[model samples]
Target: MTNRYRSVFDIIGPIMIGPSSSHTAGAVAIGHVANRLFHAPIKEVVVRYFESFAQTHRGHGTDYAIISGVLGFDPADRRVPLAVDLARRQGLKITFIEDQGLSPIGHPNTAAVTLINAEKEITVWGCSVGGGTIEIRKVDLNGLIFTPQGPLPILFVEANQPIGAALDQLFGENYRRPRVTHQLADHYIYQLDLLDRPFPEQIDQARGMSQDLTLL
Candidate 1:
């Protein structure tokens, strides 16, 4: 597992504008990362809640919190409370699905968010373990796990051809570790956890080498 908790405050909790860190703040963090993975203007969103989240999402303001993050608002942003209205004004459609039986063996506070636009669609599965901490379990049906550390550069690459050598040259020195997941055939998902932000030129170069790529 990737350790992101840098200080006592991270373990304690995040400073956020919500009642419960797990239900609200963590949901926001999950949505935020999902947005980054999508990396495009969102036309619609479908958020599926499971177990504990399915039971009390509305009362705990999890709906608003997740939508707020999808709109690119941070957990501490004041706009969280008005996410629904803001999304409406921005012409973004949202749909919520609650399923208690979807993943009985999975974490209690789990959510699967699907982001869609005209050209592409992406799905992210996340779990809130508590104290505003979250783990991204899967992306686009591939099992790739990692925690979203604040301001840490994360890169997602999908390609039909092998690009391991390119990746090694691009991130071997600066990244802590790289998680690669095989999709169908020769396709792959390269999830790179970087120590620092890469240059814009490097990002552009990566974009040229893959079928799809996103950075966060």
Candidate 2:
């Protein structure tokens, strides 16, 4: 799979984290990207885990990793403990879904984050590629934009529902469902390729994290 998409290296460069870098730090990175995609100040986040993330997330601190990421913290930061409690205080609702069937096309370590601010709802799907890199697949906030369909670091215009609806109309059914795999390469690179790279910047800061956690 790696052979097929040699471009992945150009995507997510490096990262550092715990034993299961892909499942832990990488997953955390995915959550972090989702956090950014929400754009709005998140009042709540319902996190759904798939495959190994659901089964052993607790032991692996996958939940903590995700919550920290959603709170906009780095995966390698030791403040994750405090971040979890802080997120709760900030009114974030986190959940875990162990649905193997629902996660059809994603890396083994995948998650669906439903973010809400007031009555507006945003759903984001992401995958944690190894080494603390992420790929954001979907983002829909009550029809609001900021989707990967555009370009990475895609300009956040603070659009309204009506504009989002118009964008939706323009997309016309193509904006549904999140896909993160290259048929030839069978691997996910978080939001690297998913997000449009209008000004491609590859900063792999997660390099040493995986080694520290012995996730080699």
Q: What TM-score would each prediction reach against the true structure?
A: 0.75, 0.61
Task: Find the candidate with the highest TM-score and give its number.
Answer: 1
Q: For model 2, what is the C-alpha lDDT against the true structure? A: 0.54
Cα lDDT computed for each candidate against the true fold: 0.79, 0.54
Give lDDT: candidate 2, residue 183. 17
Clashes of 1: 0
Candidate 1 lDDT at 87 equals: 92
TM-score, cand. 2: 0.61
RMSD of each candidate relative to the true structure: 4.6, 11.8
For model 1, residues 76-175, the per-residue Cα lDDT tens digits are: 9988989988997899999999985865326899898888888888778788878887766666632334343332356778899888788889766877
Candidate 2, residue 25: lDDT: 77
